[model samples]
Target: MSLLPPNKKKVAKETPRNFVIFGETMNGKTYFTEEFPNPINLNTDGNAEMIETPSINISHQRDSKGTITKSVSDVLSDVIDELQGTKHGFETIVLDTIDDIITLFEQEICEGEGVKSIGDIGWGKGHAMLEMMVRVLIMRLKELSMKKKVNILYISRSIDIEENDVSKQVPSLKKKWMNIVNGNSDYTILCRKIGKQYIRKVESKRKNYTRDKIDDEQIASLLDTVIGAYEKSKKTDVKDAKKIVEQQEKQEELEQKAKRKEREEEAAGESTKDNPDPKQDKQPEQAPKEVTKEPEQSKKQPTARRRPPRQARS
Candidate 1:
């Protein structure tokens, strides 16, 4: 009836932490992963350089000229190799924006089925293909994360979902990629600006045990905490990466100071060949130290005895 079959095989629940973010443009999504090593940014549809995160531009790997140059299957394989063979020392993976990925999918469908566009296609075949592509990507990303101990982050623009109470359809981005993103992610956040305040709310879901189980409030506040990371694990808040690097440099500075002090002390204590000892030079003219003693007591015994004897004779 449509383009392709739904990937019913369960998505592997392997990655430690998967974060999905939805916010307005320039709300610091990319900045959140800056601390990660050079992440492979699957930047399909957005201006990536603006984020200032340490990421590589690989949007062109599959996307170019308004369509995908490589088949989706081939593209997936290539991404796996790139993740395993990265030189950037990255511990995280990111989708800078998924809005553009849908565009790429539409183009890929047109290219594969020989149509000019999704709307021009005979039926909803393009939508089917788009769904399968999203499912495959999510599953693959989860597998890679588990195998490599890498984290995954997906950044997106915000949408509001109103509850009708009777029949509620949540406000969200265009459905093709949006639904898949929503369904797959363990931590989905909605970021909005209400006046001057920045608010982040957890997008609640009742995913079964097949996926990671987390409550709405927990998910939202968890996202709020700078990803509670351990130093040994290199799990760090995306914002704290720059600070960590600075601290490393400071430690190096202290080590250098200690070495400098040790070198100065050694030089000062060393005997030099330039001069003779002061004690040797002054030996001839040196005066001996003077010593003084008190005189002995005088004897008065003889006069006393003569006076006593004369008195006795008288």
Candidate 2:
């Protein structure tokens, strides 16, 4: 591949955002998202009173035939048509509290199976169902974002994820189990409460190999933001991304300095051997040899000119 100049490499365009704004229950996420537009809301939890917006209610997800139904895939397809095909002229599409949506799905599936809860299922089928739901939701979101020129907003409840203890990596609670959710979106904001205010922070620990990595400062800080519209810019999500990169650059510089010092020392030692030092404080024998040669050369040169003229003519 051809190389790009540094300035050219730095230039990038922002993707149409499929943003996830998730945090503690009633953390003003809905309040914040409403500022963008009166969104086409797939109101999963039926909690639109919290925000005043023009929203079409798909509280009971059903076909045009109005069948009493709870198929996420079917309802999502319906949701897709209304957002894109409908003459409503909606700009922003919102899916509020997806965690609750999935739970509704779980209940529906459980009821269909003549079971009471996930505990009713044997051989982990319920867990399997949850995984499938995650996949279906992710795929649907991607399709909607690309085909329709619409920005997506997904709001979810907060929960913790296990860290990779071996690698000292603090696995992102948002990314680990719900990577499908996090990866599909262009931006993700992890909201946390600090007294009366809400802080929105971005998550950067997205890679599978990031196990054992932790962001200690971020953990203590109130705000984080991850703009994942571009894969290359993931590092920018880091709170100290520039500084982290700089630190690595600094470490490399130190190593280069040490290497240069070693080379200089090697060159000096070789010079000493080729042109030996006669400074005799350490080696008296070497000094005496130098002294004898100096006098001999001086004595021979002055007398030798007259003697040579007298003796060597024949």
Candidate 3:
């Protein structure tokens, strides 16, 4: 066959792949995975029986005192075997809690060294071994998504921490392994309760979905909504935006009215100084005219006095 150009690669539709769902306990993390198409759960905590569905407890072998018997490599091999099986009949594979899986990796390291704890491998070898195990598992899980075309969901619990004086809810993982878990997934969602309802919040996208509160029945529809929202939806509330705009307009109008009133007052003051009142001018005119009338009265007063004097003499 002739080689095809890389630019002529076939186009394919993107579907949901890997998701990390984490929050407080009993917040529907497991139930959300149940909504997916035919899921096989790897229950490390042995709570799969609480889900009311068929599940496999992959972390089974333990001693009478509850010591882990399965090695990390063994568990990884079993999961990959199921992924390769044509008769496995599972489209989605879920790890109940990635936190516990990390613990199992530590146990595997201790057992290999014939020690009671990973701390026995001193000089930082324990940390190195743990990190290597985590990376190997992360690589294989990614393969399940890309090569095997299977969906993977990792469930974890949330914890609170202060970053730059602001408290935030983040997945409860050790600092050494937290970044790996966070950076490896296609989506990281936060599940929580709001009033009488539960919600799943995607922080980076500023979006939330109503979780199933009444029954597990709504999980189906919620899953569809979440998967449909590959592209982000708007975050700003419309009502809040309209309120902000109205407040700005009202402030502008008030400022204009104050300016207009100041202009009117200034204009009135200037007009009064330029043109004196007519009534004020008339008052001065009447005072001067009364002074002129007094002189005229003096002229008439001599004839009246002459008549009175003649009468008195007679």
Top candidate on lDDT is 3
| Candidate 1 per-residue lDDT over residues 1-314, each given as its tens digit | 89986869864543235667767665545555554445667666555665565444444344556555655446655876887777646667787666655566666677778888776766687777777877888788877766776667777776544222243323345765666776666556555556765555555532322213222333233344432221122368867988878877886787789899999877765633334364665558677788777776677545644544445554
CA deviation > 4 Å runs, candidate 2: 1-13, 56-73, 122-126, 160-177, 193-197, 205-314
RMSD, every candidate, angstroms: 26.9, 24.2, 23.0
Model 3 lDDT tens row, 148-241: 7677788888899754457888888776676786676656778777676777765432233233321333333545445333444656799988
> TM-score for model 1?
0.51
Ranking by TM-score: 3, 2, 1
Candidate 2: global Cα-lDDT? Answer: 0.61
Residue 215's C-alpha lDDT in candidate 2?
A: 29
Q: Model 1 — which ten-residue stretch has the worst lDDT?
A: 225-234
Local accuracy of candidate 2 as per-residue lDDT tens digits, 142-168:
777677656678777776543322322
Every candidate's lDDT: 0.60, 0.61, 0.71
TM values, all candidates: 0.51, 0.52, 0.61
Itemize residue pairs with steric clashes in candidate 3: none
